[model samples]
Target: MSEQLPKEHVDILLAAAIAAPSMHNTQPWRFEVEGHVIDVYLDGSRTLPAEDPTGRAMRIAAGAATFNLRCAAENLGYGTWFGLAPYPEEPDLLARVVLEPTGARNDDLLDLAAQIPYRHTDRHPADATPLADDVRVALLQAAYAEGAELTWLGETEVHTLLDLVLDTDLREIHDWHRRTERSHWVGGERTADGIPSSALGPRSTSYPAAVRDMGTRPADRLRDERQFEERPELAILSTYFDDPADQVVAGAALERVLLTATRAGVSASFLNQPLEYDDLRTKVQRLTQRPGNAHMIIRFGRTRTHTGTARRPVADFLPEEQS
Candidate 1:
């Protein structure tokens, strides 16, 4: 049977959920709580039609939020049972989670919960130092635990992937809609949601940047320029299918790997430009030599500390009746 969680517990869970990273920090999620049941919904109004025409990125972000909700529940001595797209009639409802009182806790999830506040997308150049083998193994295990595959790319594969990214970037340069949409959420004045200029990393001095250049405006040109890593570590996170449910699973796996990297003192960022195109996405899957749809291209390494983007208060996500 479900238990009635205190308001304080609900607050912590919602806070953790909103902390999950989204593309351009859109933070496109909503919540409703009744007793011990928490419903997660995709805020359709927040969608970036130009960049995320298929809504794949939004679903992934919702999945990340769901994972965080579970972790927070476990941390508070509650076991969670959740389902993706639980209501067929309510297409916007992405997930429904029930909290059950469990005296026992998931130690692994507890450890991950502790790292939540520390995990941020690092856009600056990472140190050329490679990840330790054991660390790589842990990241793989983290993904497997969440029902996804994380494949580390080889030097040649990384180069090939970089070529695809460059092609996508060139295509985006001429796409006015995409450029405007990206700028809407990134490299602007600080806001409650979306990335601020302060967190926008320096521009890369070389082409085929390991990091996505988020500086999209003339004012952004004034930002500092730095040399990014020549051979940065890269990995691909994939799922067995391209369905909405599968995308949610991919997001959960992505967050697990991110938190694991954070606990190991590794910084991470995304190179998801290629994944936005169908052909380039297929090529990315080919790089894996594995049977799955590529969802994200993650770059992991050690880097100097950087501030995380801001998030809206939990109250903003609650429905009017609940609020």
Candidate 2:
């Protein structure tokens, strides 16, 4: 808080922040800077009413951006301090980050900064090859560093999780509103935001994929059908509790894990449909022995498909200049 950060540093931080993945690539975050402090707010206009009714995923997305901000700041010889929901009265204001010059740099987070742009969501079928044991250990450690737990699922848990993911497909298929909301963000010629058709990967015509079928929807005739891996490599990320603050913390951990995976040559996608529902979220918690609230279901493997999602420009996310 004592240091006056340069504008160029803040610009680099915001650039890294917007690169964090969001649900359906909605990129629901905005920022304002006062002195050296940056306030992160949720964009109420970009809500996913159908996919994220409670705005849980929205907060997580913002949290990931906040983490990126912290990482970028540290790499620039600055230390960051933040609090979630600093102004409870203003609920849309999710978190505030203060950047101060630090004589010592955080090399670990600085290393992660390099992976920010390379970590894209991979929706295609991950090859059946198992992750290297050491790599799995590294990923788990990465989550631990962020105050969250990542559990690699066994066969039994994977089967149950797959069932839960498929159940969501059934619910989505019958709900016109839900399908329509999803269609708005996926398999389109969207340039700034939303998943582009090429990033949609192949459609799963047989068994339900752990990943959502953004490409195969009826309106999208351009999406090609293909079989996904019958059994995807999966993991469950959970926080110690479920609340606005914990959700944000989980988002930070999620991004750390993602960057670690990217550095290790692993690609990932989220099976968020099940985690979107209260009932399904509870079940996923139980599958983890009720240790904590399950925030995300992630699938990982090696895929050559580098179809990264779209991101809005930093100018679009930056707050208006102070008067």
Candidate 3:
């Protein structure tokens, strides 16, 4: 008889899924599976209550997990079938995926799957060298595959986007409620979820205008003033609708671009500040010359940093059956 598929296979899949970047590397999600049915849950403990008070980021994270699970199952020779939030009682359960036998594997899936571990959110200034035309095209194609579009901001447009992000940051920083909520995620040291000071680079005061400052700590003292790149490459991910499902698609696409960049020897960091504030989100939509439902901004280029950020062990988030 054929050897039984280890029940631990689902846990392996969960490990791969959480490796995807999240806002603040929050890793804001959980999973449960029985047989082939896998259920994804949002771990409230990891929620970014300051910026994403209503758990929007958690839904986006779950959406990213859904995409990763699909790719992983295909790599393992299983066709994926999924449904969204089948049980109303379990509101945090974002998705349910079922794996079915399918004897097929392709290079595209393998190429992306190979990138699962290498992808990291590099915050250090990207190399000043501009991206080649072909690299930009490839990255754009990666976004399109997941039903989203990427708009590369021109040098002339960078300042406008920066202003919107900074404005959002100022609003968050001054809000007493937001301040308390952000403090809850970080203790004296780094944990599995939330951005750690070590990962925030040496910058002090505020984060770059294009990045979200999840209120972990001011790395201003550690940042190299000259090393900060003035004209970082900026790209926006957009969908036609501004709904929960659109956020998920944008997130999955965001992960696809991130992993593709990792495989291509490019490093990326994100600035979700514009999307965090409603007015700023509208401004980004106008700036991108697209619909007003922009989900995130990603800055990418070559960077010298090589460290990967922290993540909770897969067993911690996996359901008992798989664990």
Candidate 4:
């Protein structure tokens, strides 16, 4: 039989796991390894009190980490058996993963695991070209593997989604709760959590806009206007239920699809504006013909600029309950 992976291998995987993109790169999680079992902890310290007061974003972040862990463990030839929200007493303990029977790592697993580092959120506008047929099929397959559906928004749906985004953005900008939430997540200097000014795409006057501008008011760093030249290719991930469990599942699928796109030489951005407002969220679901819960709206295509976002160190946001 092959030798078991060393402790350092687990640590490397944990690092790669946190490297998975969370909403705003929040990195809201920690890890605990005991023998072959790995525990994932949800750290509410990084939770956006205003935007994600219910800790949904944190759950989704943990889901992204879970996806990364699964990919890395599979790359090392271990099938993963994981339990979600394992302990009734410990709400922060999001998941526990146990290694399954040993086998050789598949090449596809390695390819996906290798993409953990290179997949950054490209907020700039994409080139005005549609995705290749083969690439789109691959993305669909990846999304399906995680129990979610990825559907492209047609012209009418896209315009409807764009309008919903703009309306939501405007409302959030004026709403006290949203303003407070943005401030809480962004920190004082755009140093950690939430979208940073550097990744806010092009700067424009307050309008019903699709993208959130972390650069608004006392602006720090902003992207050039030329990057927002064309409308982006938008897609949505939908699940059958609107519960926390389903949200986590949707998030995991979202990461897998994003990684697949990244591997296929595509760039993407997430626009959750429509869903931030309950009414708009419902409108979007109906518009997209989503028979279930529409979790997030994502845009993908080729991009001209690459702007790297910031992430909190693994030490800062990790919870101590499992440590």
Q: What C-alpha lDDT values do all the predictions have?
A: 0.92, 0.85, 0.74, 0.73
Which ten contiguous residues of candidate 1 have the minimum total lDDT?
Answer: 1-10
Residue-level lDDT tens digits of model 1 in 86-199: 888998888999999888889999899999999999998888788999999999999999999999999999999999988898888779999889888887787698888888
Please give the distance, in angstroms, between residue 306's alpha carbon in candidate 4 and its true position after superposition. 1.7
Question: Which pairs clash inside model 2?
Answer: none
User: Runs in model 4 with CA error above 4 Å?
Assistant: 1-5, 187-195, 204-210, 221-223, 227-229, 315-323
Worst 10 residues of 2 by lDDT: 214-223
Runs of candidate 2 with Cα error greater than 4 angstroms are 1-4, 216-222
Better of 1 and 2 by TM-score: 1
Across 147-237, the per-residue lDDT of candidate 4 in tens digits comes to 8889887878877887887777667656887666555555235555566666666753434444545654455434455435345577888
Any runs in candidate 1 off by more than 4 Å, and if so which? 1-3
lDDT of 2 by residue, 1-323 (tens): 54555778777999899999899899999988888999999999899997788899998999899999998888788888899888879998988998888888788899999988899998787787889999999999988898899988888888898888888778877798877887788776777899888787877777656776666356665467777776777899999888898888889999999999998999999887788889999998888775799898999999885868777778788766631
TM-score of 4: 0.88
